[model samples]
Target: MMFEPFQRLTSRTIVLSQENIDTDQIIPARFLTTTSKEGLGQSVFFDWRYNTEGRLRNDSPLDGFAPSEFEILVAGPNFGCGSSREHAPWALSDFGFRAVVSSDIADIFKSNALKNGLLPVEVDKKTHQQLMKTPGAEVTIDLESQTVRIGHDWQTVFEVEAFARRCLLDGVDPLGHLIKQLPTIEAYERRRDEL
Candidate 1:
């Protein structure tokens, strides 16, 4: 899926400091019936967002915060640690998060997130602590420089897989990136056929 190109993002963060947040917590298993990415935003953290009676929870971390105001989610360590579900990132993306910052993100989850246009930024423990402590702090994530900066005070480098970074920079998923090279691929095929 072609998504909004991610070059540089500067926005306030939504901090969810609870560690070991699995895919089920991100999007409960019961809500995974639909394959559509749309409308899943409502189901993102559904259990936490609403109570048993389907009412919004008063103590939810996301309470009183508009998703539009926060593009980055500074989550606790081991974010997205459970089963490999693309739905996790889908729901997050639909819910308006462009990136998830953490000390350590699960490998499968991170791969799925990157493919789905959700930048999984793994920072050092100190940086993660700083982010977790300061809720609603303005931060900047620059994909080109591979750096995450908090104003002029703190800045740190993060690593993303080279191909994934390229895809994110161009705002294209893996398939989309391959599609863009079709003409060259066709040319090569034609030459091989001629030979």
Candidate 2:
């Protein structure tokens, strides 16, 4: 069996209005030059979050929050709208973001997140804008119903790639998904090996 549908993600929300935020922005190319999740957190959106000297400053949009404290990222249209780097999801996951809510996402990026267990939910422009302004925008991603509720009245219907949704619902890794039929796999392997 795969991951039983997720219940909720309750944590601090990060607001990222700048759209077309690509993989490089999430984890710069320079950082991509390391494999450790160890320091990737510090480099997430390094260009936007820190200064030339690698110092954390308070003059940015994502101020007053750190990676460890934030779990939800509310971003603008076409968020994650750039290069198809798998490292992007790695950085987000290692940084501790359980999910991301955006107006839209690049096809590849969305797929990448799903494999890492990070949800990429789509809420239309109106809901996206509203979520941007919702102080703390506590987003509850209900996998059972495919709806995202931001407080009481603010609810939006979200969609994901069908296979990705199924993967999340079943908690099956890409290969584990195939291995889900272990009996069949074992039978086939035995037959082939015996030959």
Candidate 3:
């Protein structure tokens, strides 16, 4: 699969201000039955966005905002804190979020996200509050510089592992990247056989 490079992204943001949002809440367990990533986007944050009757909640934040208008999510502390399911990141990515900004994120989730080509950005509490304060604001995430630009003249730096950063900037998943180096691997093997 061809992954999109995440160098610089400037798009409207959606803030889920509540803390400790888990994988189940993000996509729910019932939805996890499918191995395919397709259609998972529609179920993202499914429980929160719907009622018990499977009807769209009148007060759903998703209803208030179209997915096309936003590509970034500004979430509260301890985001992605539930089960270490890879589907969570897949759901988020399928839902049109290229990156998620939070004050704190679960380590396993962060690693899963990075592998899936989703940038998980951790910012200071102050910066997180600032981002939440301006929901729908156009935020710019510069993966190249490892910074999130909030509003005019205000920006905060984020940390991503160098290898993960390289993968994201290059738009290649780990397996895909290794696959792309097949020629070099073959050449090395041939040379070793001759020796």
Best by lDDT: 1
Worst 10 residues of 2 by lDDT: 1-10
Residue-level error in angstroms, candidate 1, position 71: 1.0
Summarize candidate 1's per-residue lDDT along 1-195 as a digit string, tens digits: 767788999989999999899999999999888967788888889998898999988687676778788999999989999888789999999999999999999999999999877899999999999999998999999999999999789999999999999988988778866788999999999999999
Residue 59 of candidate 1: its Cα lDDT? 86
Judge candidate 1 at residue 69 and give its lDDT.
82
How many steric overlaps does candidate 3 have? 1
lDDT of 3: 0.88
**Candidates 1 and 3 compared by TM-score, better number:** 1
Candidate 2 lDDT by residue in tens digits, 77-192: 78787787778887887777878888888889888888888898888899888888874766677876888887778877887778777778777777865767899989999999
List TM-scores for all candidates, in order: 0.88, 0.82, 0.87
Global CA lDDT computed for model 1? 0.91
> Which lDDT tens digits does candidate 3 get at residues 91-177?
999888989999999999999999887899999989888999998988999999999998798888999999999988988778877
> What is each predicted model's overall lDDT from 0 to 1?
0.91, 0.77, 0.88
In model 3, state the lDDT of residue 15. 85
Q: Give the best candidate by TM-score.
A: 1
For candidate 2, the lDDT comes to 0.77
